[model samples]
Target: MRRLALAAALALSLSPLTAGAASAQTARATASRGLTPAEVGTWITGLGGRVGPVQTENGLTFFTVTNAGLTWAVFFYGCEAGVCGEVQFSAVVPGAGATLDKVNAWNRDNRYLKAFHTAAETPTATVQYDVVVLSGEGVAQLADPLAVWLQLLPKFAGEMGYVAP
Candidate 1:
């Protein structure tokens, strides 16, 4: 009887019915909500990046993400009352040895990630990804973009012959 009770409890814990209801509750609670600039800043800090104070211009919000010798400008999009659906992560390549050729090469080989030079003197490498902001997994989904940024930051720096400080 004890064994049967244990088995029943385990089954209930793993039941799809219970799991679906829990997820549904979570989705409802966060459905209208989206990612926020403050959350991104906190997340960047958690990733060992030095985050500067967040700033807003017009409807866009952004902050600085510094890791080792690399610094990035992270921006949020689709924000309404602090919520956002997407993020753009960018790092400016140092101007001393930067070239548009390298930027073009990166863009040619990469899919979602790219490198470009604006009218600004420094070349910039960037990655942007959309977040699922109206689902139970919305917040967790942010790891997707962050993971890409983490993976690319060092590699891109190396490609540019940058020595991390």
Candidate 2:
């Protein structure tokens, strides 16, 4: 009976059904870059879009999150211990309205990211959604959160389908 109770407790803790899909959804990710710190910063190392590296936090570098037609992406660059590199093509929560607020909060809550700031508004269309940049640990400890953000954005859009662009 004690074993059964423990199993039940574990299941309950992991249960997303209770919290709803919005709370339960997770990210899909892949890492394919080995860019050095300098390489990650070069003015010429453009991402799949025009997003540019502009700042750093701890060892984590921050870049402009850009949307290229259909895909909203950003470059989360980080380094830890003796290694440094850039994370390529991570998805970003398109801050259409309240979504940007949520994205900013997410970045603020990030444990591995700090030194947060936002550059001057470029206004993608006319309503420029702010892209808050953060700095934190990289390399060994800097992949999952970035992945989660990227993954959450698309998933959120697909599921919510009502973010009022």
Candidate 3:
């Protein structure tokens, strides 16, 4: 009788219906939601990046981010109240050796980032990558793109012949 009871308990624990219910409960407990600036800032700090004070301009929010000795701005867009749906990582360097051709080459060779040269008297090379944060996406989803940005920024600077000052 003891062996039979143990077998019955094991069968119930391994049953598909019980497993499905447990999965549903776990999913509900860890579901993703809209992103906020605090969450993003904390995530950046967790990844060893320095996040600057939040600022607002033209009704949009942005802040400075520094990681791996490279500094950039992270702009939040499509914001409602304090939540944002998208972020753009941007950096600009003096256009000393940067050319339209070089910018074009970078764009062609890169997957997630785009580069452009400004036509100002003191020209500049700018690179930007945009990531969309959807309602159903989690921290891992957002962090992956930020990680890629952090990894690629220095490479992009070198490609543009940017000498840090």
Candidate 4:
């Protein structure tokens, strides 16, 4: 919980993330913060953190996670076209493995999304997408972000149940 704040604070400190900058930067370290390994897992499931796939009216990529009677979410914000996307994954609440499967499921069915996994050391999952920068989500007529989200999801599922720094 507190660690997440510290981690986010530290991560945020690395760069000036005002509305100006677009695209996610390196995953800068932040001491030991956020949810615990197990809790983080649950949070991924939709309990206390942002987990499940979500498309806002404003067109932002927002998802949720659940844990211990809590609901959390992650907001993948800021970007457009093939340009810079202010990559920001924020856990709404610090819970447990609450939205992992949901995220995995969404990734499996999505089309535009692409899940990137490294066989080496700590296998990580990332999505390659093109979004509409203005709204910060998906467009009603355009299916770019939705498609990308679907594409880069299954790969992440293969590495499901992941938890670490």
Highest TM-score against the true fold, candidate: 3
The whole-model C-alpha lDDT of candidate 1 against the native structure comes to 0.70
Error of 3 at 20 (Å): 22
Report the candidate with higher TM-score, 1 versus 3. 3
Q: Can you list the residue pairs that collide in candidate 3?
A: none
Worst 10 residues of 4 by lDDT: 28-37
For each of the candidates, give the backbone clash count. 0, 2, 0, 60
TM-score against truth, every candidate: 0.68, 0.29, 0.74, 0.25
Candidate 2: tens digits of C-alpha lDDT, residues 1-165: 999999999989877665665443432123323444443444223424454545666754555544323343334444544233445433332332324354356455543322122233421111112222233433333345444544454444443222434
> Which 10 consecutive positions of candidate 3 have the poorest summed lDDT?
28-37
Can you give the lDDT of residue 130 in candidate 4? 39
Give each model's whole-structure lDDT.
0.70, 0.40, 0.81, 0.40
Residue-level lDDT of model 1, residues 105-155, one tens digit each, is 767876666676543555444434334455345556667767877787777
lDDT of 2 at 73: 33
Better of 2 and 3 by TM-score: 3
Off by over 4 Å in 2: 1-33, 37-48, 69-156, 162-164
